[model samples]
Target: MIEAAFRVLKVLEESDTPISGEEISKQLDISRSAVWKHVQELRSYGYEIASSRAEGYDLIASPDRLLPYEIEKHLKTWHIGRYFDYHDSVPSTIGVAKELCRNKNPSELHGMVVIAEEQSGGVGRLGRAWYSPRGGIWTTIILRPAIPVDHVFMVTMAASIAVARTIRKFCGAGALIKWPNDIYIGNEKIAGVLQEISAEAETVNYCLLSIGIDANISEEQLPSGVKTPITTLFRACGAPVDRARFLAQLLREFETRYREIESGEYHTIAREWKSLSLTLDKRVKITTPRKSFEGEAIDIDEYGALIVRKDNGKVERVFSGDCTPA
Candidate 1:
């Protein structure tokens, strides 16, 4: 197992000197040959292990890959991210998560996560395309909650809060949530959330709560023709924030807020979301298929609709639109 091999690596790292295969086998309750095999496995994963009959095995270094063992090691949650699937590149993690849940029962995908190092055709709300290059967090969480379809948008809200909180603590960015589902730092967009639902009227089956963040990707790696200015945690912090650690923290925060939603704490979550919102009280333009209007973002209702006070003194509830700050 990768986790066992990672444990062997941990032992080698903590040991001041090289530890013999016999000692490792005794510690792990396995044969010396098994320990050697584990060492070989670690080596295959870009770990430089120095082996010698006289000294034993020493960990020289580890590659900066997003291994499951690394992410699971720091993950502390009841359900979220308990089962993770990682990929170097994919068309979309959301697509993969939807397919994964399509074959399983509700209880089977309570908190399954599908993560990708890069997404070629990542999706966003309103049939928009998301720009997801490498060195970013592009993952989708599969949730089969018992909530009604009207309240399902809260999943995206919960994920937004989770990402904002994680960036605040981990990357120390004063991250703010744009109305509906986007994260911004100052005036630049840093992350976005897209929730794809499979529902019929008031009933719901599953939801793919997908989030994409520019965690470590440089500005150069971002799509050239991006509409809005973008920045990353690496640019903000002057160093690369550990993606595995941030993912673990985000999952933990998300689980906490997700339980609140399940317990009917919508107002509580909305209050927190408002506190970190960049859209509230700001002049904004909402574009729908029929028409577009300018308004002041008043508040978010219980059903996650944006209540806007228009310039014509008419208040409008925007369920879905391309919200742009004016």
Candidate 2:
């Protein structure tokens, strides 16, 4: 039924004038009543359809939701986001991606992106609550990568670079990467990347990269009492951004960087990440499951670990942790 609706929408989109239900029925080989039903379905998904006795139906507008159909319109990636799933609301895209991995072959599910308009139970590093409201891009990409287990952090690095590039090129925002995996504009965070990996011995079985971006959210939409300052593209740019276009560009950038790592171009990833670094040469606080310390964030090693010089004149390499500016 949704497929028929998509076909109906296609016909309507291609036509300059209104298309009659009878013409649509004949083109799609469905009944006129079915055409009307499909048109209603499109309307429910935030499409504005105008119906007239003499003029038939006309498409007036489309909503800002990250519907799969909408994303596919602007998508140009070869693999990443090629297979897309969208939800109006979910507990988390991560959970959905995990479920899909269990049910389907990991190879077949590679580069599949599961997106949600909102998340009720979204989480970030260290099991912190991620404020996933509407007007944000909350998604998880399932990957069956061919890279070694120790280099999995490159996935997060590639993602952060993709996000920063997309925001800069598409939205005209000055975005930069914070150490580990966060995108920042000025002192506030605008996006974050979290990775969950499955591996055995030295081979990575699969990886789930969950990315959340505050695209079109407003100040009122932001929750109170958050430890770090969080800003949205809308607030930053003084207007709302096109979420579909931004996401499409981001996926393309990510696929490009992911391909680099697959070909053993770790230095390319490291170079790009360093050029866009906001954490380097800054005082920072690194918190792990066991300990927390303040130091000067020096550089990122080849494996994506952060190298920091502690106040006591000792250098520490952090593999996975929460990094914030001190």
Candidate 3:
């Protein structure tokens, strides 16, 4: 019904004058009664539909809802958001992506996105809870990359670079990427990425790349016990940003980097990721599932693994772990 109303409104928008019920029915191949029902539904959703005896219906303005049409109007990416599924509220977009991947064909679902205005059960890295308020950007990208399983970490690195670059471009602040997936502005975390992949023994089938940004969320909205310093765009700039425009820019940047990953030009992305990384060249402590080690963060290798030189003059390459400044 919502789609039908939008179709009617779009027709009215393209027309030079108002459209009648009969004309709308003929154009949309629907019954006149159906058109009336849809028009009423549109009104209920806060669409100002100017109705007159002579002029059947006209759309004056739309509600402040984050509809897909509004998002597509501003979305400029080629592939990142070509197909979008949105919800006013959801438990988690990553969960939605997982459910979709189970029944739906992954190869047919290229560059699809799942977004939620508010997340009730968002999970972060290491199974940590993510406090996702209504004002933040919470979304996940679904991709089927034909890369080796060992190189899957590059996807997280690519997304981290994209988010950091986008924040720096818009906020004009010095944004840096902490090792693995955190984005920071002067020691306060502003964004993070979570990557989940399903694979066979040697090939990857699909990857869910989830990125959450503290766009307009307030400090008061945050939960207690968050020890790390955190900041939002509103707090840093003293105003709310246009969320739709920022999201569009972020998707565009991500699509560009994703293409680089697909083309096996990972070293190029690795170089840029290293440059924006705050962990490189710092004395750091890394904790894996087994043990912890402290060393000088020397560099990240071509495959996006962190290389650390220990005080004992031995070097270690860590593929996945929790890293912190020592």
Candidate 4:
């Protein structure tokens, strides 16, 4: 309902003259009272609106919140982000999305996105707590793709490609896909992707694609106990990038790649991932739970494993591990 109110305000913002309540009601297909109520709601959200008996409502000033209307104005994808849920703060977007899936039918919930402005209990890969404060992009996309469990890792690859492509196109940042699920800009972490799946008998029931990016975040906005140095798109470009438009670009890229995955075009996705890789052809160390080894990351296998050839001429296919420059 608030999103609809924002749409009404947008109509007023785009107009040079004051619009009448009956006209707003006609355009929005609502009653005149409803338009008045929406104007009140807009006032509650810090939007300054002027009204007159003859001249309708006029948008005076707008707030800097990531309202659904902002994203909707820029979003152009077919399915991705078609049903978006926005929050000022949440424990985690994944948690909200999971609960939503649990309560609703999965088939009807495809491509629904849960996004938060701030996360109090955000999580990362390997059970690490992510520091998601204000001024970052924290989002989780709910997908009910028909891909099998073995091919679920490809979703992560698709998301990585989306983030890297968006950073390059929007912020002009030379972002690279660090092996597995990390985005880097010259050795500093800028973004990351996490996938949570529900499977039964090697078939996926649903997939949660969570993405985090430090788009406009500053150093002080970061929570304490951050393990490594981090950089934001704002810092990388010396100015803030438009987060809403960037997100639309990312969702478009992701939807395109996702449709490819559904069509069994795994080879194409893998080729694009390799093109954006930062770990391939580099001497790297892999740390699994059982052991750790150093080798050159030669390539990634068909199943998304990092193929490393060790110094002793032994090649290993690592399905899950922490990678770093050796």
For each candidate in the order shown, give its overall lDDT on alpha carbons. 0.87, 0.92, 0.86, 0.89
The residue-by-residue lDDT of candidate 4 on 1-326, one tens digit each, is 78688778878987898899999888889999999999999988778889889787878887655666777788989999889888989999999999999999877889998989899999999999998988899999999998877888999999999999999997677899998999999978999999999989987788999999988888787656666678898998888877888888899999999999998998999999999999999999999999999999999865788999999999999999899889
The residue-by-residue lDDT of candidate 2 on 1-326, one tens digit each, is 77779999999999899989999999989999999999999999999999998999999998998988888899988899879888999999999999998998889999999999999999998788999999999999999999988898999999999999988886677899998889999889999999999889998878999999998998899999988899998987778888988898899999999999999999999999999999999999999889999999999987999999999999999998888878
For residues 192-301, could you state the per-residue lDDT of candidate 1 as single tens digits?
99998888887788888899988899767877877889999998788998888888889999999999998899998889998999998999999999999998999998
The residue pairs that clash in candidate 2, if any, are none
Candidate 4 colliding pairs, count: 0
Q: Sorted by lDDT, highest first, which candidate order results?
A: 2, 4, 1, 3
Arranged by TM-score with the best first, the candidates are 2, 4, 1, 3
The reply for model 4, stretches above 4 Å from the true place, is 20-33, 50-56
Worst 10 residues of 3 by lDDT: 62-71
* Candidates 2 and 4, the one with greater TM-score: 2
Worst 10 residues of 2 by lDDT: 165-174
| Model 3 vs. true fold: TM | 0.88
Candidates in order, TM-scores: namely 0.93, 0.97, 0.88, 0.93
Deviation from native of the Cα of residue 318 in model 1, angstroms: 0.6
Positional deviation of 8 in candidate 1, in angstroms? Answer: 3.0
lDDT, candidate 3, equals 0.86
